[model samples]
Each structure stands twice: as C-alpha cells, then as structure tokens.
Target: MAKYGVHQLRGIIGDFSRVTHFPNANLTVVHNQSKRLNQSQDLSHIAVALLVSTLMQERFVWMTAKTNGTTYRSKIVRSMEEAFAYIDDYRKTFDTVEEP
Candidate 1:
C-alpha cells in the first residue's frame, strides 16, 4: 500500500476551481452556487485539471509516496488560489452596493 502526503491532497488546478484531496477521497472546489452542467463546468475547469493532476500523480491507477515528485507538487498551487478567487467573487456578489 502507498500513502499520499499533503501535496497529494491537491488534484486539478486551474482558473476556475481546485480539487482537494483527503486521506481517502477527492474534493472538487468550485466557484458560485450554480450546479448546472455548463455553469459547473465553467466553475470547475480548474477542479477537473486538479483531478487530472491527482490522477496523473496516481498515474490513473496507483502509486507509492516514494515516487512523488516536486514538479508535481508545484503544479497545484495556482488552482487553489483560483478556487478561492472563484468563491470570493460569489461572496462579493451577494453584498449590496455601499456608499463607501
């Protein structure tokens, strides 16, 4: 059996979303509350990329931690930022216009 580290917790990273990894599963992070296919896909492009990255890490099958690489680790950073931005935009959207 193989164990994945914190880096393994990240999957696809992109302009829209990120895929978060846990000990036993994956989480797709998206922007906005929309769950429609087109909207979700728009929001989850980054999520998909992160998932693909994770899958690539696993090589679409399985891998031991000893084989993980630093290059792979660097791949997911922007995706997390994008996911945060995606959601942050939504947060701002709900706020009313203020006289500030």
Candidate 2:
C-alpha cells in the first residue's frame, strides 16, 4: 500500500519505462483535494485498483486490461468504504482462483 499525490503519481508512472516494472497488484486512492489526472496516462498495464473519493464532477476514467496473462482491475467510487469493499471483493474472487 502506497499513497502519492497526483503530481507524484504522474512522475512515478513517467519514471517507469516498462509496464512490467510495476507491481502485480496495487491499491490507489484519489482524494478530493487532488487534481484531475492526465487522461492520456494508461494504467491498465500497471495493474491498479483505483478508488476515487471525490465530489468533483470530472472523474478519472479507467478500463480493465490484460497484460502478460494478468487481468488488471480498476474501479471508481465515491467513498472510502466502497473502495475497501471493492478491494476485498476482488481479493476474494480473484485471489482465491487456482491457476492450472
């Protein structure tokens, strides 16, 4: 679990030249105070579950994508509780799957 500001997050992503350099699973929370992220930055390859807890009308849009046989999951929510629940459900559903 790691917390980063919008600018810092952008820098981190920009620093990584390859998608494989990212962690297998990541949980990110975007608070109301943070600025809107750059829409061009694609996080599907980074394997992130994003929680947007903001009242702003303009929100970040992300889609699930598979890379290297791994399916990355992402979701946007209005509250922190919903964010945790989403993560918990994802863990229960995917983490328990037996790879064969």
Residues 1-100 of candidate 1 have per-residue lDDT tens digits of: 0275332332333332233343333322221121333342332212222222354444322232112222322232234555455444433542323225
- Over 1-100, each residue of candidate 2 has an lDDT whose tens digit, in order, gives 1365332331111111122322223312232112123243433223234443332311223322222212345455455566567667665565457245
TM agreement with the true structure for every prediction: 0.22, 0.35
List runs of model 2 lying over 4 Å from the truth: 1-47, 53-59, 63-72
lDDT of 1 at 16: 20
Worst 10 residues of 2 by lDDT: 10-19
Cα-based RMSD of the predictions, in order?
A: 14.8, 13.9
* C-alpha lDDT of all candidate models, in order: 0.31, 0.35
Candidate number achieving the greatest TM-score relative to the actual structure: 2
